[model samples]
Target: MKNTLSPSFSRRSFIKTSALAGGGMLIGFNLFQACKPEAKPPVDISQLNFNDFNAFIKIADNGMVTIFSPNPEIGQGVKTSMPMIIAEELDVSWDNVHVVQGALDTKNFTRQVAGGSQSIRFGWESLRQTGATARQMLINAAAAKWGVDASSCKTENGTIINANGDKLSYGEVVKEAAALEVPENVTLKDPKDFNIIGTDASNVDIDKIITGKPLFGLDYKEEGMAYAVVLRPPAFGKKLESYDDAATKAISGVQDVVRFGDKVAVLAKDTWTAMKGKKALEATWTSDSKLENTEAHDKILTDLLNGKEFKTMRADGDVKKAFAAADQVIERTYESPFLPHNCMEPMNFFADVTEEKVRLVGPIQTPAGTARRVAELLEREAEDVSVEMTRMGGGFGRRLYGDFALEAAEISKLAKRPVKVVYSREDDMTAGIYRPSIKYRISASVKDGKITGYHLKEASINSNMYGLIPNFFPAGAIENYQVDVAAYDSKITTGAWRAPYTNFLSFAEQSFFDELAEILEVDRIKLRLDLLQKVKGTTDERIQYSPERLENVIKVAVEKSGWGNAKEGVYQGFSAYYCHNTHVAEVAEVELENDVPVVKKVTCIVDCGIVVNPLGAKNQIEGGVIDGVGHAMYGDLSFKDGEPQSKNFDKYRLIRINETPIVETHFIENGLSPTGLGEPTLPPAGAAVANAIKAAKGIRLYKQPFIKHMKAKAPLG
Candidate 1:
């Protein structure tokens, strides 16, 4: 069935009206939508592009329907689930629909992004109302042409039917609808009447993924495009001093060797030639060896714990007095090191630049930001620059930084030719932004075997959503709560890595809670439940978490896993956290052999407000658990003198199929507006696994990559 355009209430419209009613562009909330035609036009599938057209619906002359997604598709299955929302309201057969990727037009696309798991949730209301409104307009046109009451006509399977048994195909009625005025507001279907939504829709791009179709940024190729490789500095803030391009120019297929900014680019006929030319060139780098090495970095972090001047993130009541009055105080320190993204495809971009216009195509998370920045750097108007987004091998927050896109645009402009900058696996690992290293110092007071107060101080490179989110932690919870965060700025660049600070914070907070439970001689589950009970209804100045949702996820997890009464020989640990509007609880089961902890199983319970696509949601949770476990046990990025220590997979290890853990996922059933799933589920696995290690062996694992030091600890038995 061909899906038609509709008129409905949009949050964008409401926000725009409110903004206008107040003043001008105060919040920079620009509304992007499909252009309203002077006279209605039929939905043409092939006319879809990233320019000024947002193809919410495309009806072929043959009646086949297509939905264009403005967001990038990584492994997340957004390519399948978002279309389901439109199909539901359009009342079309799923078998007749096709999904496509969106491009880099800020005026046409709806905030092109696949991160934060907002693809389905953000588009849910807009797409549904669009489809429903379009269907009504078509039915009205058909009824008017047949000289029958619109109430007597029903639309089903792309056809209009009357009570008199007369029928007309949607294709035959398109002309009349094209001439009709779209209604002001179209009624939406109730949740109970949904057919295509709330179902497990298979990923529309799965076949392409499995068969290795050309769908990723790495696979993108433009005519007359030559691959370029940049020779970056060995250390952060270091710049190129000089380079001898004799050998590179001597090589066959090597083109002009141009210097752009801090590095020289080796332009060649293909990726292999560019790489070969880059390796053959001799370049000198001026470095500051005074930069903190791995050992020095650790010492600085450890010393911060002793300092008296730490920034207060959260504080309530009197923490010093509470500690003084307590009969017992238990304190511990936890540490986590930097980690690389290790995306499978590496970083790549295709850029074509000229005096009049420039075109950029790649796997980028922020198309609008890239366009704005590129136009600024090129000294051109924003409209002259067009971005085409492709599927990323993986995002994990690295793509949002726009480093690769900027490099590609600069190189193409300098080379004055179409260029595709391809980063090798070595380049990707060594030159990418890393998850910041952190130190967590947690202290809790236990009076008469009951917890009284808690204090947590975290120090790390600040790459968190500090400015983006209104508040880092909810204002309510512990009465004498104290959270102090210290930002250590360095020459080393940092960016978001997976769930950001939540990954390390969860590990530290949940592990500390486990220790507190032991000190108080109370059940861990009961302690958390008690804390939730105390903070649930309490008031705070800012927005606090909903106690009911917090308790619900924990309750479901403990009950399903038989938390306190599990079978002997199997040790379990639990951790729960909230991020990006989603709540997740994870339980890890593990066994220690020769003091090395191996995760045997993981059970995850998620409350993402609403479940958009059941299968896709499960995939994200399961993948997050595995990814987190792998990173905590094996991932590490250290530096020697000022240079990165590990450059390839041989030096850095990864979790394989044989080492995979059995992951079980469950979703809290509800019709609430959906939240995010991509990053929230990832933050709890490390903390859960660390807690399980403590449960198995009466020892505390306070640092990341636990295997490195676990062998010297006590046995599980």
Candidate 2:
């Protein structure tokens, strides 16, 4: 049977529904579905033994709140931040909350995909209502016990108090609350009365992480779990012709060598033995013409970018007329290279498969997709496969794909035993689902310091980004606007990385806007703000984002960073973009150290609406800036003859602590719904740094890895 996923519910609709399941006063919710159980009787609360909530919150007899963080924690701090929303509304202290990782229950949860920074944005209200409903139930129970009016009693800090000053701990009243009916309507807390949210609450896993606890996907273990490794094709467009596994089977500790289509797996007692057996396979592949090198790919991409009318994602007022009548027509092409997720923990998953059912455990961004894919590969019902999420060392869009988890399931089924498939750093890097290489052509027709028309063409692998407007910024801000997408197919596996298209696209678009400012003799920040001014109060139906929010962040970034005034020895660049429903404006300050650009500081202003976790939000912005800067300066992944040239960290680099700059983060709180913190913070950072480099070096670096274009003869500011 094909798996069907339910769509995410908006804030208002989510709170209007409730699923009261399990024994205690439990409120269950899922990103994809409401609380759904699989052929089990409703849990009884009379026993006082409590476990397993509906889909999210499980209230224990001791009043222990186990909030299931539905999204994967690829170090984005969702496991801690999400539960805060629930706890705050539950009238409970943060210290009283115990967070748990949620699993794949597509039948219940709406969707479990972790990428795109949808955790907070999607769960903002569902969780709050889950908590509020429970609080109401608890209050009702206490009111019934005292035979007082329900409104006469109130809850605070996990307790219920009556008007007569009689008090009861939530733990003492939870049993009675479990027996009461779930309230339909709950009064949410006023923003001014919030306790756990909008404050620095330490990550629930902080102590576990600091103490080096085994909580990550890499550390997942199960009884009698054998180790497995796969020998994938060395290059793209190649298929495994044959494999000699006899030598692999002869090795000590090697359990079996099983070939599965384009790949072969080596099963052993341990990881080291499995790796050795995999190496011994010596798999051969059929070599064909390959998609070779960045330069070659660039040529193909350029043709695709400019060669055709292609899919016009968006078109505003007469773009042709505006461009034809322009005083200055400017066009710039930007190339963003392929980037690896390079997660600290390489891809790995543990699968226990039998004739009737399969169970999986590991770190993955998308549990629902994993279960669905594994069920398909195993030729079983989706309900027969269960996937449990573990802590991820890093996702960055890498975990969003479920291929690694599927590979583990296949090996487990063939071996007929529980097995853990581990990918060595080299294997994970070479076995690619890398971020697609992209070429963007941004052009505008300006007349007297005003952009009369705009056009953007993007050529990339697989599908394009989410349409032209709403997902793409600066849309609606111009009258004559047009955006087109074209594609160039390749054998290379490509998937979302970090912010997906926005990660690379933002840098290119923002850099071009900076160039536009340069030619027009205007402030880069002011130019963007000016465009936003045109966006104000637009009645256009395509406008999904609030221009006021965008304008606010830009204004804050300028005011807070002191736009025109530069710090000593620093040249500043400004960029603002809105994506993932979050608005961000960034100012990057740079200095030339030994003729190389060194990012000295970055001041970012965000308008993600209400601030959920202040410090955590700051951390997300800081991490994103470092990640974007590191990529802009050095992140490059390319293929030569369909083979990945950079296989490990030694070859594919990441930002180090020594290279990290001071990041100042601020948020605009306009009392709107909370948006995502993870990805929106990342999209504009690269562009901010790229523009800063141009100001510092007196040259526009069109391509990524600005260092690659540096010349020794050029004078640095």
Top candidate by lDDT = 2
Candidate 1 residue 45 Cα shift, in angstroms, is 6.4
Report how far residue 176 has shifted in candidate 1, in Å.
Answer: 3.1
How well is each residue in 211-311 modelled by candidate 1, as lDDT tens digits? Answer: 57677888989788889998988777577989999999999999879898778899998899999999988988877747658897888887777787677
Task: Tell me the lDDT of model 1 at 600.
Answer: 91
Per-residue lDDT value at 611 in model 2:
81
Q: Quote the positional error of residue 584 for candidate 2 in Å.
A: 0.6
TM-score, candidate 1, is: 0.90
Query: Candidate 2, residues 1-717: lDDT per residue as tens digits?
Result: 211223244433432342211111111222111112222223333344554334666676666666765556777777767778888888986655666565665444565666677677777766676777678778998899899998899888888999999998777777777666556557888888888888986565665566566788788887788888889988888888887888898999998887788999888889999998888787778988654667789888888975874888788899899999999899999887888888889999999999888999988877777787888888899889988778888888888887888888988888889989899999889887888888888889988768999999888866665223423568888889988898877788888888776888888888999988888988777788788888788778777777788888888998999987996778898888888788899999999887788888999998888888887788888888888888888888888888999998888877788988899988787888888778887878888888888888787878876666555336444
TM-scores for every predicted model: 0.90, 0.92
lDDT of 1: 0.73
